[model samples]
Target chain A: EPEVTQTPSHQVTQMGQEVILRCVPISNHLYFYWYRQILGQKVEFLVSFYNNEISEKSEIFDDQFSVERPDGSNFTLKIRSTKLEDSAMYFCATSQGVYNSPLHFGNGTRLTVT
Target chain B: GENVGLHLPTLSVQEGDNSIINCAYSNSASDYFIWYKQESGKGPQFIIDIRSNMDKRQGQRVTVLLNKTVKHLSLQIAATQPGDSAVYFCAESPSGGSQGNLIFGKGTKLSVKP
Candidate 1:
């Protein structure tokens, strides 16, 4: 079974700095998504990417957040200025098709903003 | 087993028992629903999903029941084993919206003891 792979399994960054979380989605999958879970909170949707553009984003995906599929296989989430609240485990998921198709997730990148 | 600091609602069950974790979704327009299992230090793993047209769907050791009338979902695990201990989450995705943009509920931690 092909799986999503994330880079820098864990990151520790200083507040006010920037960090980019990388994900390599399944080769044949088309749609990609980014979600985050604060230490004790529910997993929250941040953004969805398809066709090399952002399809939709949540309120949490504000000015500081941006997603880019720089290459055919890599999907990256960049936070311009990290805040303490931004510390969370970020997950990348991809799906073969939209409706009812299973979303394959990566092991997640733990971002610790201090 | 491992434990996460999320302090989620927990259900303790003995091995070989049936465990059901419930969720109430906030979106009535969501046509796709999924259940995910997350162990400590790992990402959410797909378990099963149910579509709007169907009320029930089953997988290897799990079943998902959807009640659109009340916007509710439940994941039932049969003959639970100690390895089944993990946090379970239910996510919803609207049909007409961006395809895989999901909204997840707070997870319920299920612990199985021998």
Candidate 2:
């Protein structure tokens, strides 16, 4: 079974610095998503991408956040200026389709902003 | 506002006992639902999923029951084992959105005691 791979399983960044989380999705997947879970909180949706464009995004995906599939393979999430509130486990998910398909998730990157 | 939530925060059961976790959703129009399991340092892994057209679906040792009438969902694990200990989350697609825009519940932590 293929799996979505994320880099730097743990990341620690200082406040006001930039950070970019990377994910290598399954080669055949067409849809990609980013979700984050704060300590002892529910997972929250941040953004979704398809066909080289952002399909939908949540209010939490503010102007400071951006996503790109720059090489048509690797998906990345960039935060312009990290804040303490940004500390959480960031997960990258991919699916072959959008409707009934289950999203396959990566192990996740734990980002800690201080 | 759309909200998906679990009824319990934690459940403890004997290794050989069965476990049942419950979830409630406020969106009646949600047609797709999924149950995911997350271990300590991993992302959510798909356990089972059901569509509005089905009332119950079963896999290896897991069963998912959907009660659309009451807007509820449940996951039952038979002969629970220590390996089954994890946080389980139920998620649903927003009423007017695709599955990529899943809204996850608060999650229920299951603990199996040997």
Candidate 3:
């Protein structure tokens, strides 16, 4: 089966620094999403993108957070200024853009802000 | 407001035994639900999903039950194996459309004792 692939399995960055997480969804998938999971907490939805634009976003997605499909097949999440609380696993997922379709998730990028 | 939660944070089962994980959601409008298994340091992997119109759905060795009236969902794994040990999460699509953006629950860690 096709899988979403994320770069930089683990990233360590200083507080207030910038970090960009990259992901490549399956070739035919049309919808993309970003989710965050704190060390031992529930996963939280950050944002969703379709048609090269954000379709919906959660309150957790604030000004400091941004997502872009720089080019076809590449989805990226950028944190303008990282904070200690930003330490967590970020997962990228994609779907076939159909009703009730399951989203395929990548292994994830572990980000640690010190 | 949307909330999804697991009844137990951890579950222990013997190999070859059956394991069940339970979840509850506060959003009555949520029509789509999914169960994901997450191994350490990895993203949530899709296991099975069910829509509100259906009361039950089964996969190879996994079954998902959805009760819209009680707003409850459950996943049952038959003949649990050591490989099945992981953190299980139940998620719901608040918008009930395509399940693009999901509201995830605090995971239930399944431990299979061999």
Q: What is the TM-score of each candidate against the true structure?
A: 0.95, 0.95, 0.94
| Top model number, DockQ | 1
Q: What is candidate 1's CA lDDT for residue B74?
A: 93
Model 3 misplaced regions, further than 4 Å: B1-8, B96-99
| Candidates 1 onward: DockQ, in order | 0.61, 0.44, 0.46
lDDT of 1 at A73: 75
The TM-score ranking, best first, is 1, 2, 3
Regions more than 4 Å wrong, model 1: B1-5
iRMS of candidate 2, one decimal?
Answer: 6.2
Which pairs of residues clash in candidate 1, taking residues 3 or more apart in a chain or in different chains? Answer: none
Q: Rate the local accuracy (lDDT) of all candidates.
A: 0.89, 0.90, 0.88
Location of the lowest summed lDDT over 10 successive residues in candidate 1 chain A = A96-105
Model 2 segments more than 4 A misplaced: B1-8
Worst 10 residues of 1 chain B by lDDT: B1-10
